[model samples]
Target: MLIRDLPYADPGVPDVRSGRHFLLWLGRRQLRGQAKSLAWGTLHMASVASIPIAVGLAVQAVVDRSGGGLALAGALLALLGLGATVGDTMLHRTAVTNWITAAARVQQLLARRTAELGATLTQRVAAGEVVAVSTGDIEKIGWCVESVSRFSAALVVALSVCVGLVVYEPELGLLVAAGLLLLIAVVLPLLPRATRRADLQREKAGRATELAADTVAGLRVLRGIGGEELFLRRYRSASQEVRQAAVRTARMWALIEAVQVALPGLLLIAVVWHGTGLAMDGRITVGELTTVYGAVTFLLFPLRLVQEFAMAYSFSRPSAARAARVLGLRRSGDGAGVGDGAGGGEARSLENPAEGDLHDPAGGLLAPAGRLTAVVCGDPDEAGRLAARLGGHDPSAEEDPAEEEGERPDARERALPSVLLGGVPLDAVPLEKARAAVLVQDKDPVLLSGTLRELLDVPGSGRVSANEALAAAQCADVLDALAQGTPGLNGDPLEARITERGRSLSGGQRQRLALARSLVTDPPVLVLDEPTSAVDSHTEARIAGALRRVRAGRTTVVLASSPLLLDCADQVVLLQDGRVTAAGTHRGLLRDDPHYRAVVTRETDDELAEGTTHA
Candidate 1:
């Protein structure tokens, strides 16, 4: 696998058993690249090891006054230099390829998982954690992957050099071997402590990152409520905790580095001391003593390689574990035998499946095809849960059975039934198909940063035009507000840029823009939860009227208790105790059902009296 071929030609299903298993899976996926890296790394290290022998030969030639040997040594040195250059270049190239390819594979997996989970992703994992995994964690994992080949090559070169030394001078070779073994024994015991510290540091850093993200996301709200100082203090505390943890982790790693350096220096001293005795005893020549000293000095390079690989692996293990946790998350009822219809098997093979009515059996509500239906729930939470179900989302579907039994009964738990489309369970439909068939706009919809034109440009664009949707959403004031701030925009809202999360716009402006974006998609079924809650009563009335007119022949389910929106619906279903207790025209329900009237007419008496006084 090369960088160009990445994101993996096929990022095959991962073995998400554990973090260690996931790392192994990555290695298997790029076996060929790893092999190439190993081969080049071996060549590089071998040439590096050969340099000491060349230098020793040159020295001996000069001492013996042999011109032919000197020339031969020079020629050999040149060849080794050329080999080292080629090997080093290719080694670097292959290592980088491995790093990039591994990171790309992980990125692709994460992107796919995010798409599959959609809005529920943040519910299961922190947004900051996801961000951390995609950025820092990915780099650590790639670093480990890149180091593996180099480490293996270093081990091979180290062993080959040791064997050659043993054959050249048995007495000095035994001493060198014992010193190497002692170094390994001393360093190996310290690794677990270092790994533990690294884990602690990473945990603290993730919490700090999460706090920072949350603070930034709600900065506007914090300023509005005079709570900026409180959040700022909280973030500062988190940052300090992260700093302390990082310092502790750094200290442990520094100890390991000290050992790596100090142990090798000791080994080099032992070889030099012992080699001098062998040369004096006439058991080894001067050239042989030089070679022994040079080889031990060169051995430090491989020892450092081993230390680097250990450090990289320690950091990457936790990162891989985090990635695996995300990859292992499956949506509720995903691949379960519960709702197995359009989302699986032969039904998924269909190119253009027909559209149908949406039904919520548990709620005892039916949103007929091509009709505007409104749902009014006494409890806002119940209403939100019902809206999510209408879009084929059930949080309980993926919950553990034991934990599900332990929770107190709520609206969702009381009636845990799947929503259906045309008698087929909605969850049974493929997510893409279900998303295309039904568009659900939550109470707090997100508006991505982009030009108005770009925001409105959605997939499948024939059913509704951007202008029509904007008008229906009553975005004229929003457009005017945005245009007033920028003169070069030519008073065209479509050309104006919205800040991240539409932060530059007011709450009402952002809400309307989100509605317009949703309306532009023109899905067969549109389920909206409090779509006009942020607007004033008059503006809400306009939106209610416009929505009725624009969605005349499409299935629209609006979960709101607002009288204006409810009155505009052809049918109003009053949801109470997690079931549809009353269903009729809004006026009919107001006249006959006291409970329904009370729920919809929630305005204070002072407000009603004030309105009458104005009239």
Candidate 2:
């Protein structure tokens, strides 16, 4: 497919058998492009090889004093030069297309997998490794995939030229073939050392990248706790380690390059010496000597291509393996199947339940549609996991090897958790539909850089307008905060541009802004975790009041123990030790269930001092 037709509608399932297999799969996917590149590369190298041959023919004609033959040779040389130029241009164009398209395909696949696995991917794979795959590894893979055709062409033309020389004059031709073989022998042995060095460099670089990402992400926290210098020093040490590794890699490659150049020079000398001897001994003509010398010199171009192929393959193999490992990762439901539900058959046909209740069979909790439900749990982590499951994350999902090539993904008894929506398992629901049906706002939601309007713009039900969402989220002052920091945007608060991750906004402001954005989406089911923890109690109370009014008669699941939020819910459920312990109105739970009150209010000292008694 052309570059414009990218982001392949399917991106197809990847082959995760091994790193080498994954790379081979990538090449096979872009067959048409590779074919075009190979054709162009063949034309280019063949045309280049013809140039020296034409010059040698002209030299022979001139020596024989044949004016007609000399004139014919001149025209042939010009034609060969033009062909070389055009072929090289087209070859480069096709190769670049192959590179970009391959990279794009991998990037799209990664994005799709990311959405499928969601937050759990970060839990299974190191953040640094993921970054390296997306950044450095992607380029390496693309480079290797695109280089294959060119290297093939080089090998073909190199062999053809050698065969021609051998047939024309056995003496000089055999000498040239032997010299080429010797060059290959010497270069092949140095590759393993270079490969090891390259792998070391990539490892160190990945560690450094991870360190830098961590330091930057925590810069705000580091500065607050006076730990900025400590991290900076640590990063410096990591950076130096990476530098040393890189230098070692460069040294190995340099030695290889030196050998490459030195061997080719010696080969050219040997061919000239042998051809001169043959010409003087009446075994070859002066013109034949010219041709043999020219061919040997030109053969170096293809030999260098071989070296390039070797280096590219060594570096890309590990990268492909890493990408394969990531692609192979499947949700725990694919194998663990802890809570089976109809073999995930219902996932594809799911839609907004409209009035269906959300049921958690394992916990025996059912949240009726069109009601505000608050979930309280003693552990924040447990609450977070519940929220994730509620948002269609397979509770039993864990990363494992994806099905091998030629294996149907459907063959696996992929059983999702029995967390059902309208009797259909949430995990079984197709991700696109699941995302649309349920909205989960995490405790630490990230705000990407953009205008306020752009941030709020999402594929929403459109039932809740921007201003209404902002009001319900208690984000009135957030507009003022944006205006004060940004210039010339006071006229329209929506136009105010926020910096990366909303760095300019305070924790409370960022939280409210994210909450407002979430509200604007107006999904069929809304699930929030600690939505107002960063805000003051007063602001939290305002949000509670507006939240109930704006989201009236809608399915809202608030996973928090905040008294204000719980009191505002139509029904409150106490989730203890990963099970439903109590379910009732917030006030009823506080008055009747001592355990519920202990979790909601943290069992404060005043209650203990009074020695509050409960039946």
Candidate 3:
């Protein structure tokens, strides 16, 4: 694979059984590039090996005073030089190609996994680990991939040189071979130490990265709570830990480098010293002695390649393991189930079948179709979990019973309760089909950085226009805010650029924009969790009314306790300890259910008065 073919091509299914298996799979995928790299690398090293032999022959010829032989030797040397230049250039090109293509393939796999898991990925994996895998991990994996062919070529050249030297002079050749073996034996044990240090460093770095990402994501909240210094100190400590680990890892590597350099130098000196003794005794000629010295010196290059290959592999193993962890994550039941009668099979429409109600068997809460229903749960976390289940995402349903034996039997039994739509189990349907039928907007919706038009250009039929969605979201003030901030927008809010996560905009503005984006998708079932939490009471009231009108005939489930939003729902269900305690109109619930009233009326009379004054 080439770099240009990337991002669009399928990255193929990976064998993610283990990190080693994944690395091997990557190598198999890029056989063609690997082959080219190997061929060029062999040629390059062969040219290098020929140089010493040519020089040895030239010295012999000059000593014998043979002009013709000298001329032949010079010609051979020139040819070797030319071949080395060409081979070196092509080798570099192919090696780089291998590196780039391998990295691209890994990146594509990561991107696909991220898309498949969507918002749930962060729930399963750390944001920093993902970032590290996509960045540093990939580079290390590519380095190992690119080093393989070169290492193979170097090994072959080194072996051939050893054989040739033995044929020319046995004693010197044997000594050199023994020295090479000694070097390998000494370095082999140190590799495990280096690898351990690398793993430690990577672990520290991943933690630091996770902390930084969390700190940045919650920077606004930290500032509001006057906790920036606390987090800053925590991050600083994490950074220091990373630095210390890196230093320890580097020290180990430096020791290995010292061994690589010192051992090779000692070997060279031993070969030369032995060769000099042989020459003095007239057992070997000066020309032959020169040949042995030059061969051993040249052998250092290939020995270094061996060292590099080992280092690259050590660094890449942990990275590949991280990558494998991500790639191994499959959606709860992706491609494993049949679809529901509605929007499944040959049917492509996203419309609900028979205007079905959404039923949560575990919570015993039912959201009737074609109406605005509100659910208020005492525990926000439980509410979010229930909301996810309503949207066909039950984490318990995806767990393995055999692995989770420690869980209570009753809890395990209750865990797999499937949310049904139109009387059909949601999990029985294919994931894409189920997702198309229901849209869940979380409490904190992310607004991607883009123009308003781009942000609202979500997948689905264009049933709702951007303007209509924006109006339904009560985004006139949001557009006005954008127009005021951005020059050349000229009051064209759709053309204005939003900063990353809408940080440049106010909290209410971001919330409204997110709501507009969700509205544009026009799904049959819209599940909103605290959609108006950031807005003022008056704006929340306006949004509640507008949302009802916009989703008049569709099934809309709002998981919130806000009085304004609940008052707008056609039916309000109060949930206490994950079970429905009361179901009625908002006014009826307030009058009859004291628990419901206390939960909904937590916003004090003073806050209500302030809201009224602001309005």
Candidate 4:
């Protein structure tokens, strides 16, 4: 089949379709690059069938004592031998190519899908499942495809041999045909159970893989909390469960294999016994009897093919199902989507979309440029939740009052996100325009492994050098912690590679590094969750000044409890529950707002300890 036909051949087209059919659909997709290989593979099986036919003719000629017939038979035998060598070599080469290409395509599809999903994919699927699909599932899917071509060609050769045996001696031919049919059709009914068992085993293995990944990621936390042994025991139990499932699957497969090998041998014996009786009765010539024997001997190869197809499918069905399940994860907008704010609701200025002031109907508040704003909250979770909402991750509870209450709710309709740039509703503008105007740096910002220069080279960061961003985040001390340009050191710290999660750096170092990267962006609107939680008060104070200098003329929001950070803000808003309770300068709240002081100061710690003691 051609490559274009592959995508249209949906294995998921019908519920009634078997695993083998799904496998065939997958095979059709892979056959595009390996068409020539498949053609050569077919020729090899056809060439093998020629040997049995040539032997049968040669036998009849020798029995008749014909000299010319003997010469022709020898020539045919030589031709058969030549075909065998060529076919085998070409078959091996093609099969290997198909295997590698199928694997590569699956890998490419997964990577493309991941890129398309971006940050949203991580929120929905586990990291370990993605890891498992790329590494293990891809190989299994490839094996299933490559085996189809090999088995198809062999099956044709087997049928051709059976027809030849029937032509040479009709009565013995009938016996061979019936036996072969039984071998293929009757034995296959047992496979569904085998496949089901294999599916269970693979699922258990995937769970084990996920657990192992979790343990590795939380290894430090587990140890610090004295729960390492607890987690280790849990992982050990999970591993044992996987092992038990695998063993059960193995037992079922082994039983099927035993039947596969034994049944074919039994059929051969029965055919031989019946054919000999025919020869004695003069219903078949002695040479004809010999031809039937040769045919069955050759048919052994295809007989094995039929059995292996069943076995290969038993192993591959689970893997295919898993891949399908992963691909089936719906995109965010595919359901009742939070309005992407791309094209709906009221149109407004794209450059400085207003943040409709905390769901206040008195129009959105424009963030004044080059100023620091403090946001206080009673519920830390609620505050964090609002931050995520503001960042345009998912829908926030804050809704727009401009839209009529009776407007039809479309699952795809996302309320325009209420973020403002210089008093403009960020969602009122196009997403691309909004992103350019406002940037929210979340708590625990991820630091990808890269050089310091690479990290600071964000778009719109201006011509400000890496050193400047580092200076802004007060990261000079952090840079010193690294062994930069030291002789006998394996690498420069400025160029030193961090691990995937930046595990090599201290918490403060990572936080500062993340902060510096954000500073390098220099977007008009900067919202930082907590920039100096890791550093001591002295370092925090220095960072506050550095931040003020770097962010002058930029609208920056610092959602922090540190007085040092709040002391630098131009204004502070105290939010109780979900609504704004008070708005004033940092010092104004320290004196006039007892609730603010109780929530923000060290007395908050004493109160928490007292509450814990009472509990």
TM-score computed on alpha carbons, candidate 1: 0.88
Query: Which 10 consecutive residues of model 2 have the lowest summed lDDT?
Result: 332-341
Angstrom error of the Cα, residue 290, model 4: value is: 3.3
Estimate, for each residue in 95-168, the C-alpha lDDT of model 3 and write its tens digit: 99899989988998998888766666675678888998999999999999999999999999999999988887
TM-score of each: 0.88, 0.87, 0.88, 0.75
**What is the per-residue lDDT of model 4 for residues 15-124, given as tens digits with 9 covering 90 to 100?**
11333444455566655545666577677777776776678778888889987887898898888778878878977877877777666666665665565344444454
Q: Of models 3 and 4, which has the larger lDDT?
A: 3
lDDT score for residue 192 of model 3: 96
Residues 382-443 of candidate 2: C-alpha lDDT, one tens digit per residue = 88778777876753444344433333343125534557777776665556667778888888
Query: Clashing residue pairs, candidate 2?
Result: 332-397, 332-398, 347-428
Global lDDT of model 3: 0.83
The residue ranges of model 1 lying beyond 4 angstroms of the native Cα positions read 6-9, 333-355, 361-365, 377-385, 397-418, 573-615
- Cα lDDT tens digits for candidate 1, 1-615: 666655565677877656788899999988998999999999999998998899889888988999999999999999989988999999999999999999999999999888877776675678888888899999999999999999999999999999988887788888888888898898899989999888888878878888888788889999999999999899899889889988988898899889888988888887888778878888788888888888888899998999889889989988887787777655433534423453453354323223466788887998888888999997888887787778877755443323321332232343366787766666656677778777888887888877889899897547779999999999998888777765699666799777788888888889999999888998878899999888999999999999988887888999999889998998999999888899999999888776687688875667656755654
Lowest lDDT 10-mer window, candidate 4?
397-406
